[model samples]
Target chain A: MKEGRETTGGIEYVVGAEKGIREIVRDEDVMPLLESALSAGASRVEVTDSRGGTLWACGASSGNNDSATVERRPVFLEGEPAGSLVVEASPGSQLRLNDLAGLLCAALNKIITNSLKRMLTTEIHTSVVNRTYEELLETNKRLRASESRYRELAENLDRKVQERTEELKRMHTRLIQQEKAASIGLLAAGVAHEINNPIGFISSNLNTLKRYISRFTEMMDFYRAAIEEADKAGGGITEAACRKWSDLKLDFIVRDVEELISQSLDGAERVRKIVSDLKGFSHVDDSKEDIVDLNTEIERTFNVLVHEIPEDAEIVKEFGSLPGFLCNPAMICQVFLNIILNSLQARRQGLKLHVSTKHVDGNITVAFSDNGPGIPEEVRNRIFEPFFTTKDVGAGTGLGLTVTLDIVTAYGGDIEVTSCPGKGTTFVIRLPAERREHVKVR
Target chain B: MIEFDRTEKRMVLKLVFYGPALSGKTTNLLRLHDLLSREGRGELMVLDTRDDRTIFFDLLPFFLVTPGGLKIKVKVYTVPGQVKHDATRKAVLQRADGVAFIADSRVSEVANNYSSFENLEKNLAFVGIDIERIPLVIQFNKRDLSDIVPEADIERVWRPTGIPVFMASALEGWGVVETFSRLVELTYDSIDGKCGLSEGYGLDREDFVGRLTKRVQGS
Candidate 1:
C-alpha cells in the first residue's frame, strides 16, 4: 500500500524519491545499493536512475540534521521505489548516517501497510451501518400503519355497539308499551260495561216521559173545551164542571208535568253526552289525529272520571279562552285522564284537584294541581320514567307518565312537575299554542 | 290460514308441514319422497342442517297438470322442529295455502305437540296468515311404536277444533299418502270455491285429484 500525498502552494516542485521512484527503481545497478543500504541499518535508503532522477526510496525519516551524524529515509507512494535514508542512531546520538538509513526503510514500509488496513475497515463499517438504518426505517413505517388501522377498527366497533344497544333499548320500550295497552284495553272493556247499564235505562225513561207529556197536554185541551162551552152556554152545569176540574188540581198537574218534561230532557242530554265522551276516550277511530275542541274534551273526561273521585273531594277549573288546537283528541284526553286518576289515588279520599289553563308566550299552559299527599322527593325525579309508578304492579304499569311525556314531546311540548311532600303535587304542561302547518292544513 | 290463488290458468298451491322435534316430520317427507313418482315432482331441496334435523326448512314440490291445461303445483315444506328456530318457521309459513301439523303419537310427546301447535299459531300471525281460515290437517305419526296414545282419546281432544286428524306410521310408509292426499283435496276444493278453479280455469276435479294422488303415490 502507498501513502496518500497532498501538495502545498508552489509552482516549482521537488519530486520526492517516493513520488518518481517507480520509473527509476528498475535499474540493475541500483537494486543492490537499495538492498545493501536497508541491511546496513541506514535511516535513509534510495535508488535513482542512471540520470540521477529520484527513483525508489524506503524509510524516509524527517528531522533536524545536527552536528552528530543523522540520516532520513524517503517514503514511496503507489508501489514505487523512492528516495531513502539510513540512520545508525537517533539524531541526538553520535551514530553514523549510513547506519540510520536502513532502519528508516523498514519503518516506512510498516506505515503504508497500516494506513491501507484502516481505510478498508472504515469503509466496511459505514456500509453496514447505512443498511441497518434503512431496514429500521421501513419497519417503523409498517408498524405505524398497522396501529392506525387498528385504531380505526376500534372506533368503528364502538359505533356499531352503540347503535345496536340503542336499537335493543327501543325494542324493549315498545314491548312494555304493548303490554300496558293490552291491560288498559281489558279495563276499558269493564268500564264500558258499567256505563252502558245506566245509559240504557236513561234512554227508556226519556221515552216514557214523552208519553206523559202528550197525555197531560190532551187533558189540558179537554179542560179548555169544557171552559169554552160553559162560557157559551152560560149554564150552571158547565160552570160546576170547571170548578171540579180546579178542585182536582189540574193547574198543579199541568205545571208539574211541564217541570218534569224539562228535567227529563236534561237527563237524556246528560246520558247522550256521557256516551259520546266514553266513545271518544276509548279511541274507536285511533288511526289519525283530528281537530277537536280541547275544552269540550276536558269536560267529557271530567264527566267520565268524576265518579272515580271521592264524594267529599272538590274539582276546580280555570279554563282559558282559546281556539281549538289540532290534536289526537282521544290520546290527549287519556293523558289528562291518567293524571287526574293518579291524583285521585294519591289523595286521602276527600282532597281537591285544581285544573287551570292559560296562554303564555305563544304557548298553551295547562296545570293540574292536587291537594293530595305530595310525591316523595326521591320519586318526583323519576315519575316520568317508564315503569316507575308508585302504585302496585297490577294496579298501574307506571307507563302513564312516560306515555304522556312521549305524546306531548311528539307534539312539540314540554312538561314539568312541582311538589312539596306534605302539601300536594302539581303538573304543568306547555304545548305550542297553534297547530303545526301540516296539521292545520289537514 | 293460507289463501290459494288460481288467477293463472295453472293453479299453484303451497302446503306447510309443521311439528316439534323427533315428531317424524322429516321421516314423513322421506316416505313421500320414496313413494312419489319422479316425473311429476321436482327435486326435494333440504337446506343445511345440524344433528340430522332441519335448521331452515325442507321443500318437496309436485306438479299435477289437469287435462284442461291447468297446472297444479304443490310445494310441500317442513319447518325446523326445534323450539329456537322460530324465525325460519315464520319465513316458511308465509304465503302457505294449507298446513299439516305432524304430532308425535307417543303419550309423552303430547305436551310438545300442543306447544308446537301454539308456536304454529304465533308464527302464522307474524306472517299475517289467519290460523282459522287455512285448510289445516293434523297427522299423528309413529302409531306403530309402543306407549302410543289411543285414537279415540286423540279425537276427543281435537274434535272441537273441527280439523281432520289422521294416524300414521311414517317410517313404514303407512297412512303417509292418505294424509298427503286429504290435504291436497281440501286445498283444491278451497281454491275451487274461492277462485272457481273448476268453472273459471276449466279444471276437472276427478282428473286433478287422480293425477295428484297417483303422482304422490308413485303409481
Candidate 2:
C-alpha cells in the first residue's frame, strides 16, 4: 500500500486522536487569510471543505465566463489534504497575478498549519491537566479512607489492650492449674494408704471390746444361777458361781475394755485428720482469701506429700515468730507444696531441707534451703520459667517453680534463688503483710 | 510510533529528548539540526520560549525514502524541562518511538537529574508507553565542566542497568551525534523486531543510521 505522496512534513505532532478540518479550522482564522488574499489583487478568494462546501470567501464572484482562470491548491495536514484554497480572477488579470494564487495559497497553508498545531498542543495540554487533576482526586479519596481506618484503630487501642491482658491472666491461671494437678494427683495416691492404717487398727480394737463384753455377760448369768441355787441350798451353790467368775477373767476384761475404747477413738480421729488434709489440698483451685499461717501451710504440704518423702530424708524447721498473714490458705499451701516438692525431688538419699518462716519489716519471709545436688547456675536462672525442666520427660510437668512464683507475686510478694551448684540451693520468698494488693500482670 | 499507514506509503516515528531544566535537551536537538544533512530533513521549528528557555517544545523532522518509494519519517522532539511544564512534557511524550535522556552532569544537579528521570518514567507511563521496553539512552551532558560526575563512577553505577549511557558536553558539541546515532539505531532495531514495522517494510539499518549520523554507509 505504499502510494508515493510527496511530504512537506509536520512541525508539530498530535498526542490524542486526530481532529478533522471542520473541527480544527475555525471561522476567525480563515477570514484573515481570505481578506489578505483578496487585498493582493485576486478578484475572488474562497476556502472550501473537502466536500466543496465554501466555509469562507472574499471579494466578488467570477461568473461562468470562458476566459476566467481558477487556481486551486489543496490545504494539507500531515500530508493529507483536508480542504482546498481556490483563487479566481478574469483572464487579463492572470499574468498580473504573478502566481499570486500560489503565494497566497502557501500563506493560507501556513496559517492552517500553525492553527492545527496550536489546536493539537492546546488539546493535549488540556487532556494532561484533566488527567492529573483526576488522579489527584483519587489519591485524596484513598488518603481520607486510610486516615479514618487508622483513627478507628487508635480509638479502640486501650480497651482492646486491657482485654488481652485479662485474657492472658486467665490463661496463666489455667497453666498453673494444669501443673498443680500433676503434683496434687501424685499426693492423692498416698491419701488412701495414709487413711487405711488408722481404719485397720480401729476395727481390731472394736472386735476385742466385743469379745470382752460377751465374757462379762456369761459371768453375770452364772452368778444369777448360783444365787437361785443358794436360796434352796444355802452356801452350797456359792462355790460354782465363784469358779465361773474366775474363769471369765472379769477384772482384766473391765480394765482392757476401757483402754480399747480410748485407743479406738484416737484411731478414728487420725482417720478424720487425714480426710481433712485431702480436702484442703484438693480444693486449691477454689481457694479464697483468709487468715493464713504460712508455717502451718508448709507443715500441711509436707503431710500431704508424706508418701513421696523418703524414709531417711531430714527436714529441719526453724520456726520463727510469724504473725497470721491474710491470704488464700489453699493457694498459699500450693506455693509451699511446689517449693517443698522441688526440695524432695532434688535428691533421693540424704535429702536435707531447711525450712524457716519469720515476720520482719511488715512482711513475711519464708525460705526453704535444700542440701541436695544443688542447681547449676544456668538451670537455676531458668527454673522459674514455665515448662523448664531438668527432670526426665514424663517425670516433670516443669511448671512447679513457675506456679510458686506466680502465687507469691500474686500476694504482693517476690521470690529469690541462690545456688552454690554443689553445696545447696536456697529459695527466699517474701510477702508484704500490709499496704499491698495483687500485682496486675501485664 | 504514531502513524504507520501502509496504504499511504508514509511512516511517522517520534523521538523525544527528555531531562531536567538546563540539561542540554534543546541543545542536543539544535546540534542534531545543525549536523544532520538538510537533504533528508525538514525545517526545525522551535516553539514558544521566554528568556531563551523552551516553554513549549522543539521539533525537527527527518524522512528517509527507500528505492521502493516507502517514506519512513522520524520526527525528533525536545520537551520543556522545567518542573512547572510537566503537563506539556506528558503531552509531547505521547507515542514516542525512542527517547534520549539528557541529564545534567553537575554535582549540584544530581538530585534534579534523578527527579527528572523519575518524571520521565512517570510521564512515559501516563502516555501509555512502557519505560522498560522503550529504546532509550542516557547522556550526561555538561561533562566539560568541573565537578561533574566522573565517567568511571557513572559507568560503575549505570552499567548494571544495561541501558546504554554516554558522556557529553552538549554545549561544545562533544558526544551529541554518537548519542543520537545509538538511539536511532536502537529504535530501528526495536521496530524491526518488536514494533511490527518489519512486517510492513524491511528497514536498511546501516544506511538509515549512517545517513542520520552523517557517517559513510557500510562502515
Candidate 3:
C-alpha cells in the first residue's frame, strides 16, 4: 500500500533474483524439444544457465560421444542471458542445427519469462492480501477499544444523571427549609408577643399574692402583740386590740386572697400552653413520622399563629371525624399554617377563616376557605409556583405555598385553589386515607 | 492515495463515498456512472446483498491521461454504511484522498446523521487520515422525499465548517454531478499542492475535472 513503486499492468517485475532454476525451465519440456530437433537431423543438444546449471541434455551431450558440438545459442530473457543451449551435428547439418538451437532457445526463453511473470503476479497478490488482512486486524482491535470506551461512557451517563437528580432534590429540600426558617425568624416579634401576654399577667398576679401574704403577716403580728399584753394584765381583752382586729377587715382579705391564687394559677397555665404551642410549631425533625390527625395539626397551627391573626378575624373550624393516617406531622403542620396564614392575611378586619376536614371515599379533604378579597384569576394558577408572591417583599418569602404544595404532594396528596374575584378563596387539599410508606411525588 | 507507481508513470488515487446506512452512498456512484462519459470511467462493481444493501463495497474506476502522457487513475469506493460493518468500512477507507459524505435529509434522521458523522470521523482518524487535511464534501441526499431537513437549516449548521455542502436526490439524478465535480476539483487541487500534479506531471486541474465530469454521449 506504499507509493512510488512500479506496478505496471499490476505486476512488480523484478530482475536477477531468480528463486529456482529448475522451476523455470524444466528438463521434461526441454527434452521433448531436443528429441524433435534430433529427429530433424540434430546430433545432440543440451541446455544450461549462464552459471552452467543444467536444465536438459540429450544425444551426444548424454556422453555418447558420437557427434561433436558445433553450434550454440544463448537464451535471453528480458535482454539478460539466463541460459544457453548447444547442439552437436555433422558438418552438413550444421545450418539445421543452428536453426534448431535458435528455435529451442526461443522456446526456453518464453517459458522462463512467462514463469517469472506468473510468479511475480502471485507474489504481489499474496503480499497485498496479507497486508490488507493485517491492517484489518489492527483496525478491528482499535475499533473494539474505542467501542468499549463509548459503551462505558454511555452506561455511566445514566447513573450520573440519576445521582445528580437525587442531589438536586436534596438541595431543593434544604433550600426550602432554610427559607421557612428565615420566614419564622421574621415573625419572631409576633411570637414573642403571644408568649409575653400570659407571662406578664402571671408575674402581676404573683405580686398581688405577695402583698396579700404581707397583710396576713401584719394581722398575725398584731394579734400576738394583743395576746401578750392581755397576759400581762391577767388575760383580758382590751379596746385597742378590738380596734386593730376590726380595722384589718379579715373576711375581705381571705376572699380576695383565694381569688388572687386562682387567677395566678390560670395565668401560669396560659403561659405553659403558649410555650407548648411554640415547641410543637418548631418541629425540626420533619423526617420522622407518626400516626397524625390532620385536624390536630391545623389546630396547633392556629394556636401558634394566634397573635399574628388580626383581632377582628374569626377562625371557624368544622372538624369531622377522621381516621389517623401515617405522615410526617411537621410537614403537614407547615402546609396548614401556610393556608391559615394566607386566609388571615387576606383581610385586616372581618376575616372569616373557615377550615373543614372530612373523610369520605378513602380520601380526606381538608379545605381552608376565607371570606375576603379573592386571588386574581391571572395570579391564581401561579400561586403554588416557587417564589411567587402576592405579599410585600418583607412580609412574605414566597416559598410558603410552594413548600405547602411540595409537602402535600410528597404525602400522595394534591392541593387545588379556587378563587372568585370579590368573593373568596378556597384551598382544597386531598390526601389518601391509607398510609403509603414510600411515596415520591413529582 | 492508493498507489503512485512512478516507474509505471501511473498514480492511483482513491475517493470514498461514506454515510449512514440507506443514505444512498452507492446510489451516488451509480448516478455518477450514469452521467459521466465512458471515455475516462470503468464499470461499476457493486458487492451487495440480495436485499440491495452494500455488503462489502462498490468500486468505480476513473482514468485521466494528461497531455504529457502522465496517467492518473482514480478508484472510487463506497464502504458498507451499516453500523455493524465497521471493519469493512475501515478496510475500504485505508488511504482515501477525498471523501463524499452522503446524509439522510429526513428531519427524523438528524440524530442518525450526527452519529454516523461522528463514526466517520473516528474511523478516519483510526485509519491515520486527518479529517482537516483530507478534502471532504457533504451531501444531504434524499431531498426528493418529504419531511426533509430544510436547506437553510443545513447551511446554518454546516456553514461554519467551510466544507462544500450539496443537497441532492441521487435517485432523481439531481445535484449528483455537481457534488462529484466539486469533490474532484477539491481533490485535484489538494493532491496538486502536495505532489505538484500540474507542475510535475502537467496535470491541469480544469482539464482533469473536465475529463471526469464530461457528460455521457448518450444518456
DockQ of 1: 0.00
Q: Evaluated with DockQ, which candidate comes out highest?
A: 2
Give candidates' CA RMSD values in order.
40.0, 7.6, 12.5
Task: Evaluate residue A136 in candidate 3 and report its C-alpha lDDT on the 0 to 100 scale.
Answer: 79
List, for all models, the DockQ compared with the true complex. Answer: 0.00, 0.20, 0.07
Q: Between the candidate structures 1 and 2, which one is better when assessed by TM-score?
A: 2
- Which one wins by DockQ: 2 or 3? 2
Ranking according to TM-score, highest score first: 2, 3, 1
Please state the CAPRI-style docking class of candidate 1. incorrect
Candidate 3 colliding pairs: none
Please, what are the lDDT tens digits per residue for candidate 2 over residues A1-442? 3222221111133553344676777878778767877776677888887778987788887673343467788876544466888787765774445377778778777877787678756775666567677668878999999998889888789679999998998898788778768877778778878878888889998888789878988887877877888888788666786677678887778888888888889999987888778677655444656676778777888888888789999989998978888877777888888888888888899999999988898988999999877888767679988899999999888888888888788878999988887788899999888736654332
Candidate 2 residue pairs in clash (backbone atoms < 3 Å): none
> Per-residue lDDT for A328-360 in model 1, tens only?
776677678777878988975678899998877
lDDT of 1 by residue, B109-211 (tens): 9899999999999877756678888888999999999999999999999999899999999998888888888887787787778766677667766766666
- Candidate 3 overall Cα lDDT vs. reference? 0.78
Collision count of model 3: 0
For model 3 chain B, give the 10-residue run with minimal summed lDDT.
Answer: B41-50
Error of 3 at A9 (Å): 23
Backbone N/Cα/C clashes per model: 46, 0, 0
TM-score of chain A of 3: 0.75
